[model samples]
Target: MVENRARGNTANAARPGSDAGVLVVGLGRFGASLAATLDELGRDVLAVERDPDLIQTWSGRLPLVEADATNADALVQLGAKDFPIAVVGVGTSLEASVLITANLVDLGTPLIWAKAISAEHGRILQRIGAHHVVYPEHDAGARVAHLVSGRMLDFIELEDGFTIVKMRPPQETHGFTVGESHIRKKYGVTVIGVKPPGQPFEYATESTRIDAEDTLILSGDTVLLEKFARRP
Candidate 1:
């Protein structure tokens, strides 16, 4: 398992706290990104996947467990119940996803987040007691459609139901400091990050300026988000 000790900041994770260790079963893009981001924000990670090569690649990067998360006993062996939160991220494989969700419920894995392929799969996850169920592909497609329409760049929903969105800076808010533009005041969206021209996004800074080409990643209510994104 990988553990980080960064000073000052408390951890931010999709899983709950109290037990620092996090078990990410399934090392697909989403699982891998989730593990990395959690570690980047300083949480201990214990990652698992059925692919031997993928496990080998990530071995020791975190406590990489080479096992099929779909197996009930395997997850227990990997100490999944030791953590407060667990993520079941098997993609496309409906049986595997269902089995893993069932396993977590059977083992009483406190908070389980599962990825599903359909509405039916979502129902099964709910039946098995998944704390959260995500249709990542659908969600991503929605954001991409908006982006393709030149209306948004990216969108992430933090656990609290607050939407975090990156979009082509709106006309009124372009070319202003975060506070000067008053995104919070006018749109009620918090300017969590801003990308300036020819520069990478300032991910967690408020003082960053909003340039014409800049994309703003904001956090706020969904209604307000839709309002900001819709064409005038």
Candidate 2:
């Protein structure tokens, strides 16, 4: 059984206007990074790890529960059921990730995010009730492919056939007002914002001009996005 190291009763941990915080299972790179980022963002975070030594290493930094996250009772004992969000981050262990996700689901956690080793693993996670499935390896590979292709500065796939992309404005479109570019009419994409070199992002408007090095943030259907990307 893991010791309950939460500052107070799990049911009462969240104040009236505050959230119940997040529960991170596993202590690997993904879990650690999520926990650290949540803590940095001023969220309450409780981390779980099978290895006591790892918890000791992270002592004084994050609240922790030393136990096997794959065990449903272990998680229940840690008061994980009350957390608003639960993340299963045992990237290399599909079984562990699935088990933790199942436990969180049974606990009625509002949101569950699980890391998957492959598409099949992701499907299993979703079937077992993980609200979000992340494929870090696949996503990284896609990002690298985009960068190597020299068309995309950044990429986010919102769904199967829609994407949000950041890329340099087409050379021919330079010196034209945003409305004059006819991007929506010509390419079927929406320019949401512009990023000039060394400056903050500026939301696009009718009068915004496209400069030589300005990057554009756009959203559109996948086919249209690919067509737009292939442009020089």
Candidate 3:
């Protein structure tokens, strides 16, 4: 049985091909978080979940329906085809995840983001037409590892091995202009910005001096970024 508990203005619902709204399938941790964030951002979101308990828990908080996303008929009933973007956050059961993703693909959801537990799972999702595959656990673990291993304040890994990090300026860079320190030439990393204590962040330039007390925002290949952050 499909139970819709969506609240809000139906007139404001996004039309097909519009980027104004998103359909999230599954109310697992990832899906719930994503939906909440989107809602906070003021985007129209409709969440579909199979579990009645999960639906009840999120009721009045999110516009959602109680329906198994693996069933294409249920999705059709929910106007899934009209949604420009969809996220498949069912990662617990690989079969269910695949089925839900496949159903979304068949419904012509223009953009599909799916969660995968492993490389094999990710590959399958991509092969089946998931526009984006996220490995939340793997990514969180890597981010935490980077933070604990060095003096890094934060780390963000982007596609193609590129990475960005926030860390204190190395002792070698103290009191020297960016060009004089030769950080990019020596460490193969570019200091993109700097944030001093109680001061607004500013873009880094060749003439911008690095202070040991200031935080540096650097970008480079993952390996080089890690090596540079390890500097004492």
Candidate 4:
């Protein structure tokens, strides 16, 4: 929401200029949507695009650099160092993504969110100091697989030994508030949230009751959750 433009350096007053306004590398569908979303939310968005056409298209709406995001020198000349938070959204070109992520890390970006093509790519990004790495497609596919496999409702991987999962409530769970379920002792999983049919889900309170059709967001080991998900 940087309404006041002070010279070439416009400080996002809300987040501050020093806060590392979001820097998005790459200009594809995902990149465009992300940039547009930020702009809509009054966030100052600076982007780097390797493709000339893409850069030209978004330059008017956003601060775009029509150069390879992989080049440190090129980015330094174009104001990349000013931002601390960056995302490498180059999905099609794996080479560019790797080099650009590496270059950003070298630039000392405090928070780097990189998209990985596979687990191997994720490992590479992690090794290079990427704050977090994700394979959106792979993760989504895992959820879909679970649905088809008829196990859990939703599965989210957190740190090791901890996971956030939604389980299909059985008849026993019906008419029981979260506190009454004794979830922690019974399932060895902590019920952190709940999702009931035809209703929006939110963090589960002690009073949150479990309906037969409700899905629970539980946190614990994946193995036990899987076992619970399969049990009748």
Query: Candidate 1 at residue 79, lDDT?
Result: 84
TM-score between candidate 1 and the true structure:
0.66
Candidate with maximal lDDT:
3
Give the higher-lDDT candidate: 2 or 3. Answer: 3
Candidate number with greatest TM-score: 3
lDDT of 1 at 1: 9
TM-score of 3: 0.89
Write one digit per residue (lDDT tens) for candidate 4, span 111-139: 67787777767776666666667676777
Against the reference, the lDDT scores of all candidates come to: 0.74, 0.81, 0.86, 0.74
- Models 1 onward score TM values of 0.66, 0.82, 0.89, 0.71
lDDT of 3 by residue, 1-232 (tens): 0111122322334334443679998888999999999898888899999898999999999999999889899999988887788988999999999999999888877677888999888888877877778888888888999999888999998767898899988899999999999998998999999898999999999999888899999999989988888888
* lDDT of candidate 2 over 140-201, digit per residue (tens): 78767766675778887766678889988888779998899889999999999998899999
Please list the Cα RMSD from the true structure of every candidate, rounded to 1 decimal place.
7.7, 7.3, 7.7, 8.0
In terms of lDDT, which candidate is stronger, 2 or 4? 2
Residue 158 in model 2: lDDT: 69
**Worst ten in a row by lDDT for model 3:** 1-10
Better of 1 and 4 by TM-score: 4
